[model samples]
Target: MDNEEVKLLLVKYITGEATVQELEQVKQWISAHPENEQYFAQLYETWHNMLYLQPAVVNKDNAFNKLSADIEPKQPSRYARLITWGKAAAAIALLTAVTATLYTRYSKNVESVRQIAANPGAIKKIVLSDGTQVWLNAGSKLNYTADFGKTTRTVYLEGEAFFDIAPGKKTVPFIVNTKNYTIRDIGTKFNLKAYATDPFFETTVVKGEVSVEGNIDNNVHEMSRIYVKPRQVLRIYYHPKKESYSYTAPDTKNLNEIQVSEIDSAKLDRYDGWKENLLVFDGTTLSDIAKVLERRYNVTINMTDAELSSIRYSGSFKNIPSIEKVLAIIKANTAINYSVSGNTVNITRNNNND
Candidate 1:
C-alpha cells in the first residue's frame, strides 16, 4: 500500500515468509506499473546476492553507519526502506552488484532466433504461436524470432509461402520479410514468392490489404511502399544494375520494375493452387514451367532447344500421378519428345512428327 508496507512485504518475500495474499498483492503491484517492476527487481536482485555472501565479510556496525549516512529523508519514498534495513542495506548494495554480473551472463544464453525449412517437392504447413497459418512451398524456408507475435509479428521468407494471417492484437502488425521487400498484413490472406534464383519477387492478395515496401538506395528517403487490395497481384522485379522502376501489368519480364495489377478472384487458384498440392499453369512459358516442375517434383528437366523453351502451355493437374506422368501429358499436348534417364529428363522438339 505505502512505501513502509511495501518494504516489509519485500522483506517477508525475500525471506520466504510471505503469505499467499501478500505474494499476490506484490505481484499485482509490480505488474500495475513498469517502474514498480523495476524497483522490485532491483531490491530482489540485491536480496538474492546477499544469499551467497560469506558470513565473515559482513560488518553489521559499519554497514549500519554507511546506510544511515547514505539515505536522506527527502529522497524517493522507496529508498526509505534502505534506512529501515539499516546494517542490511550495505549487504544489499554488494549483492546488487553481484546480481548484475550474473544477470548479464544469463541474458547471453537466451536465444530468440527460430527457423523452419521446407524440403523440395513437399509442402510444409505451419501454424505460428499466434494462430497464423502458413503453407510453405517446396524448396522454401521461413525464419522468425522466438519473440514473434508478442510485441510484433515478423517472419523472413525465402522462396514461396501462402499466409492466412489471423487477426492478432491490433497493436501488433504481422509482416512477411523478403530479400528485397516487406509485406505488412492488416488481417489479410496473401501468397508471397521470392525464390533466390528467380529474378522477381511476387505477392498476390486473396483478401484484405497488405503493404509492400522496397528500399532502392538502402535509406529511409529512398524506400518505396505500396498497398495491395484483394484480388490484386504485385510483382517486384530486381535488376542486376540496381535501377528502380514500377508498372501495372499481369506479367513482366526480367527488368527493373515493381508492378501491381488486378486479377479475377475466380482465378485465385491459378496463383494459390500449389498450397493444395495442385499445379496450375496459365500460358506459362516452357522455360519457366521447367523451373516450377523442378522445384515441385525435385527432378531435373533439361531443355537445350531454344525454340522449345519459348513455347507457351496452359494446364492444371492435381497430385494424383507422378511428375513423369505430368511431363508425358505436357509432351503430348505439345509436339515435344522427352528422353528420361533416372532423375534427368531431356526434352527436344518433335522433328520426326513435325
Candidate 2:
C-alpha cells in the first residue's frame, strides 16, 4: 500500500507471480490511489501499441472487441491474453506456479532467520559443526543458527538431550541451556534431565567434568555447587526467587554443601543410552517407564489404577518395547491386568485390594 511496496508489487504483478494475498493488496492499492491510476494510464497508453498486433492488419473493430473481452476486469484480464498462442496454456500454468513459489520463498526467507526447530521423531540425533553430538530425546529440540561454530557455540534446548561433546581445547567451550540454567560442558559426556515443569535440574556426567549454574540474576547457583566427576550425577535444585550460592568462593559459611554422588557408570549409560538405539532403564517407577514408552513409541499410555503406577521397573528396549512383555512383567510384580487395543494401552487392577 505504501510507495515502496507499490513498486515491488508492480514488478511482481508484471512477472505474473503475485500471490492471492499480494494480488488483493495491489488491487486495493490501485483502487485507492488516483495518482497510481493516472500513472498506470500513461504507462498503459505508452505500452498499448507496444503490446500486440496492429489494428490495421486485422479487422480493427473485431480485434478491439476480442481485446475488450479478454481484459474484462471481472474475469481474466489483458495480462492473461499476453500469453502467446504458441504456448499459451503452458505459460499460464508456469506463471501460476511461479506465483506460489515466490510467495512461499518470501515467507520462508522471513521465517528461517529465527532458528526454528521441531522434533520429528522419538529419538533424533543432531551433529553440530564443532564435532559435537546431540541426542535429542523424545519430543526434544535443539535450535541454533548456521553461524554457530564460527563466533560461538550457543544453542537453546527444549526438553532433554545427551551431549557427547568433542574435546575442546583449553580455550573454546560447549554449552547447553534450558530456561532455568546453563550447563557448561568441560568436554564431558553428560546426560541433562530437565522438564519444563520440574523444579530440579539434574546432570549426570559419565566422562570428564561439568559445571552447572542456576539463573539467579546470572550469578549461577541456587540448589548446590556441582563438581561433576566421572560416574558422578550432580543434582541441583532451582528456586525462581532465590540467590546463587558458589561453593568455590572464599569464606563460605556452610562447608557441608550438597556433594555430587558417583553412581554405577553402567546405570548412567543406561540413562544416556538412547543414542545407541536403546531405551535402557534402571529401577524406575512403572509410571516413569510408561512415560518413556509413550515418548519412544508415539502412543498414549494411561493407568487408571493408582497402585499399578507405583510398580518399579528395570529393563531395556529398542524398536518398540513389546507391550505384552512389559505388562506381563508389571502384572507379575503387582495385582494389575492390562490390554492393548490398537495403539492404546490400558492398565487396571485385577482386584481392588490393599
Candidate 3:
C-alpha cells in the first residue's frame, strides 16, 4: 500500500472498522520491522496521551511541591496496560484507535516481522544488503531476515524483479530463490520473472551472466541448468507429461535475426525497456497485450470477450509518452474500439455492419 493507505488502515485499526484481514495486515506491517514498531509506538503514545487527558480529575495542586517544585504530575499511560482493554465510548476517532489496539490477537511466540511493501499497482526500489540495486516488479513481494547484511545478504521473491548486482568477488554468492527455481550470481545484472499462469520461468541477462537451476528435479539429466550470455535469455519450461525439463526458445520469433525494411528497429530491448517503464508489443494477442499493459502502466486493461484476445498489432513504444498516440493511431486505422477510464483501458470490436 501507499503511505496514505497505510495511514488510513492504521486509523481504521485505531478507530475499529478494520476487518480480520486488515488487522492481520496491520500486525504484519507493524511487526515486520523493528523500526516500524518503534516509530509507530511513539506516534501511538502521543495520540493516546492527547486522548488520555480527555478523562481527567485533579489529584492535588500543591502535592508535587513536597518532592520538587519543578516535578511534573504523573499521568497513567494507556498503552502500558497491554493486557487490559478498556472501552473508548468517547468519539469515533478515539474508538477507532482503541479498537485497533484492543480487539487484535497475536501469537505468543511470534518473532516480530514487518512487511517490506510492494503495492499491487506500485513500483518499489530497494538497496540489497550487498549494496546491489533491485527494482521490484508490480504485484510482487520480497522478504528477508532481520540481520540482512550482517553475515549474508539473502532475499525471497514471489513474482518478478530485476537486479543490478554490486561486485563482491564471490565472498557470499548472491541468491534469489523463487517457487520452483533459483538463480545464483557472483556479480551481474539480470531480470527474473516467473509468469503466474504461464508455464515458463524467464531469466534475461542485460549486462552480465547468471546460472539458473531447477529446485525439485533430483535426477541430474532431468534437471535444467543454463548459463545465459549478455543480452541473451534462457527460458525453462516444465512438461508434466514426461515429468522432465529442458531449455529451448528465447521466444526465438522475437529474436531480431532478420532485418525488416518497414520497422524502425529489429530487436528486443530485453528487461531494460520494461524496467525503464516501456511496453513494447509486437503482434501479441490482446490477452497478452492486456497483461503487458497492466504490468507496464499498473492499470487494468480489459477486453470485451475471449475472441477479442486474438487481435494482433505490431508497434513499439520505446517509452510511455508514445503509448497514447500509438493506441489512438491503431484504433484510427483498425476496426478496434477503445476507451480509457481512469487507469483502466477497455478494448472492444468496432461494428463492421456500419
Candidate 4:
C-alpha cells in the first residue's frame, strides 16, 4: 500500500476503530519489514505523546446518556453504526489537526519530512525533484521536505550516501545535515559517511569543492568552515563526553577532532566503490568491518575478542562475494577464527596465531 493509505490504516488501528480485517492488514504490513515495524512503533509513540499533551476531554456521563438514548428503542442499524464511526473519525481528525498546530507553534524550523531508506544488503538510487542524484548505501536513511529546491535544498542523513548535486542554482545551496556536522556543497559531487554507530565520520570530495562545519550542539567548537577540494577527504573522530563525579560543572573540553587529507585521484574507488557493487576496506578495523559486512550480508557478527576486534585490515571484493569467502580470506591473514551459527557469525582470537 501507499504511505498515505498505510498511515490512515495505522491511525484507525491506533484509535481502536479498525475492523478485524484492517487490524490484520496492519499487523501483516508491520511484520513485513524491520523498517515497517520501526515506523509503526514511532507513530504509535507519537500518537500517545500527542494524546497526553492534549487530552480528548469528553463528558463521560453525558456521552454515555446520549449513546443510551440513541440505542434505547432497539439495536442500532448498520447506518446508525456507520454514523457513529464517522463521528469518531471526525473527532480523531480534529485531534490530529490540533496536535499539528501545537507542534508547529512550539518547534523551530519544523517541516513535514519525506524519508527514504535503504535496507541492509541493498542499495538504492534516487533522483531528487531538482535533478540531483543520490545513491544511498545499505542501512542508510535520507530525509527531506517537500519544499526541497524551491525554498531550501537541504537533506538530513543518518548513514552513508553519494550525492551528485545538480548545478545552476547558485542562490540555493545544497546542504546535508548529519548528527555531528553539516556539509554544504559548492557545486560539487561528494560521498558522505556518517553512520551513528560508527566512531568516525568522513566526507570525500570526488569533484569540485565543499565546506564542512561541525555542529555546535555536539560540543565541537573553535573550528571554522573547512573547504575540501577534489580528491580530498575530511575525517572527524568522535570523542564522546564522559560522565563526571562533580555535577556542578561538567567538562566539555574533549570534543570531536577533524582531520583533512588528500587522496590519490586514481584511488577514488576506495571511498565510493560501493556504487559499483564493490566492497572496499582500507585499513578498517575489524569491528568497523563487521558493521559493513553486517549491512552488506544482512547477518549478525559478534566479536568476542576485544583485541581481535581492533585489528585493522585492508581488502577489496568485487561483485559482492559470499560472506563465508570474505571471512575465510580474513581468517587466512589475521589471527582470528570465526564460526557461523545460522545467520550469526562469532569471531574469536585464533589460538594458533603466530
Candidate 5:
C-alpha cells in the first residue's frame, strides 16, 4: 500500500480500530523493513506519552483539520472520520502535542514548538521556518518553537547535525544550544556533534566562522567564548558527572579540557562525509567504532576481549557497506575474527596480536 494508506492503518492499529486485515498489513509492513519497526516504536512511544497528558480544551474539528493539513493536504478517508471519538481522543491529543506545546503568553511569546527526530541508521534533512537547512544524523533530534525567526532564531540539538543557516533580516543571530555549549553562528556553515553518551563534544566549521561558549551552572560563560574560523575544529572533552567546564574548578581541571586544531581538506571531508552516506574512521578505537557501526547498521557488536576492543584502526566506507563487509575489512587489517548470528556480531582475538 501507499505511504498515506500505511500511515492511516498505523493510526487505526494504535487506536484499536484496525480490522484484522489491516492489522496483518501493518505487521507485514513493519517486518518487511527494520526502519518500519523503528518508526512504529517511536509512534507508539508518542501515543503512550499522550495518555498521561491532562486533556486541554482543544476544538476537536479544528485540531483534526489542522492535523490533516499538516500531515497531508488531501482529504482524509471516510474510515478515518468514522473512528469513534472515544477511541481516537488519545491519538488526536497526540497529534496536537506533536504539533505544538502551548506555553503561557508571557513566556517568550511562543505559540508553537515542534521536534524532529531521525531514527538510528537514518539521516533526515529539514528546512526550518527561517529557511535554514539542517541535516540530522542517525539517532538525533532537533527542537524549535513556532516563533523561530520573529525575535530570535535558536534551535536545541541532541546528537549531530550539519547546518547551513540562512542569514536573517536585521541579523537576528542564529544560535544552537547543546547540553554543554551554545554555538552562535557568524553567518557560517558548520557541523555540531554533542551526543549525550559521547565523552567529547565537537564542532567543525566549514565556511565562515562561529563562536563557541560553554554553559556553566546553567549560565552561558560569556568570558569563555571562543571564535572558530573555517577549517578549524573545537573539541571539548567532558565527563557526565560534571556536565560543563568551569574556568575555576580545580578538581575538574584534568577531567575537562578544550582543544582547537586546524585540519586539512581530507580531514574536513571525513567530518562532513556522513551527510553523503560515508562512514569514515580516523584512528578510532574498535570499541568506539562499534558504537558508530551499531547506529549506522542497527546491529549489536560484542568484543570478547578487552584488548581487542581497544585496538585502533582507521578506514573509510562509502555508501554504507554491509556490516559483514565492514567487519571483514577490519579483520584483514587486525588480528581478529568474527561471527554473525542474526543481528549480533561477536568478535574474538586471533592467535597472534600482530
Candidate 6:
C-alpha cells in the first residue's frame, strides 16, 4: 500500500476507528522501525496537549489549513496522503473535544482558567497548555488561563512546583506568579516553593536564567526585579507584626526579605527530588523537616519540646511507606522521642523537659 493508505490507517488507529486488520498493519509498521515508534509517541503527546485548547480558537477549516501547510503538495503519493489524513484526524479529534465541552460547560465571555492541584495526599505531574511540564508537590496548586501561550504565558502558583519550561518565545515569555514575587523565565528550568502559610518563599534555578520581579499590593510598577542563575536559590521572607503596644509605639512589621545564595550541585538536585517521591535533607532543622513530612504524609506533626524542634537532621528517604520509619531514623540519630496518637505525631526531647 502507498503512504496515503498508511496515513489513513494511522489516523484510524489513533481515533480507535480502525478495523482489526488495519490495526495489525499499523502495529507492524510501527514495530518495523524505531524512528516510526518515536514519531508516533511525539504525535500522541501533541494530540493530548491539543485537546486543552480553547473552544473559540479551534475550527475545522483552520485546523485543516494549518495541517495542510505543514504537509504540503495537496496531491501526494497514497502513502503520504494516508499519513496526512491520520494526523489531521488526530488534530480534529482534539479540537472537537474542546469545542464540544466549551459549548456546554464554559462561557465564551470569560477566558477559562485551568487549575491543577495536588491534594494533601497526592502529587501530580501536569503539562500546561504551552507544553511546559510541571511536577506539583502535595498541597500545591497551579493555575493558568486556557488562552495561555497565545499572547503571553503566565501561571499562578501556590505551594511548590518544579517547572521545565519550553524554549523562550519573544512574544510570550513564561511567567510564574507567586504571592510575593513573579518569576519570569527565559527558557529555564527551576523549582519553586511558595506556600501561603510558609514564612518564606524559595526559588531554585536548575538550568538557564530566571528574572524575579516583586511588587507592592495594587502597585503599577515593580518594587524589585532580580535575575537568578543555575545552582542558586532565592528566598523571600514574610514577617508580620506580632505585638500591638501603646498608641505612642510605632508599628514595626518587618518588610519582606529576599536572599540569594549559591547552592552546591548535589544539594540542588536534592531540592528537586521531591517530584520523584524522595525526601533528602542536609542539616535541616526538625521544625522545618516537620513541615515537609506533614505535607508529604498528609498528617499532623506536633513538637512538644521546643529544644527538640531546633535539632538539626540529615537523612534521605525513598518512598518509605510508614511515618514511623522516619521518626525512628530521627530518634536513632538524636535525643528525640516521638509518640503517635491517631493521625498526629508528637515529638519531644528525650531529657523529659516537656
List model 4 lDDT by residue over 1-354, tens digit each. Answer: 654456567666644456667878888886765434543543443433222221234343443343333223232232222212244444334334433433432222232456798998889999999889999999998887656776567777878999999984554678887754668874679999987776677999999899875432243333335788999998877564356322222122344566789998778898898888888888988987998899888899988777977899998889856789899988888888899988899999998986
| TM-score against native, each model | 0.63, 0.55, 0.54, 0.65, 0.63, 0.63
Cα lDDT tens digits for candidate 6, 1-354: 554465566665543346667877878877765435544543432332232333235555554444334233233332232233345454344334433432332232123667788988578998877788899999988776666776457777878999999875553568777655668875789999987667777899999989876532223223245778999998766564455311221111344566788999878757899999899989999988998898888889988777777789899998888788989988888888888877799887887432
Model 4, position 121: C-alpha lDDT score = 84
Q: Is candidate 4 or candidate 6 better by lDDT?
A: 4
Tens-digit lDDT track of model 1 for 202-301: 8999999998754433233232457789999987775543342222121222346767789987788888999998888889999888888888888788
RMSD of every prediction? 16.2, 22.0, 19.8, 17.3, 18.5, 17.4
Model 5, position 283, has a per-residue lDDT of: 91
Model 5 spans > 4 angstroms off: 1-111, 216-222, 240-255
* CA lDDT, candidate 4, residue 277: 87
User: lDDT of all the models against the reference?
Assistant: 0.68, 0.55, 0.54, 0.68, 0.67, 0.67
User: Looking at candidate 6, what is the lDDT of residue 236?
Assistant: 65
lDDT of 4: 0.68
Question: Could you give candidate 2's per-residue lDDT for residues 226-246 as a string of tens digits?
Answer: 457788876555443235332
Could you tell which candidate, 2 or 4, scores higher by lDDT? 4
Off by over 4 Å in 4: 1-111, 216-223, 241-253
Alpha-carbon deviation at 271 in model 6, angstroms: 1.4
Best-matching candidate per TM-score: 4
List the candidate 1 regions with Cα displacement exceeding 4 Å: 1-111, 216-223, 240-255
TM-score of predicted model 5?
0.63
- Tell me the RMSD of model 2 versus the true structure: 22.0
Identify the superior model by TM-score, candidate 4 or candidate 6: 4
Worst 10 residues of 2 by lDDT: 46-55
Which digits, one per residue and each the tens of the lDDT, describe model 3 over residues 1-354? 644456567665543356667877878877765434533443433332222222133223222222122111132243232212222222223333433333231111012222354665556888876788988776766655454554334455666788888877443457665655557786788888764544456777777778764432323323234566776766555442233322232231222222111112234453445656655666777676666667656677767766777878766665555335656867775667778878778888887823
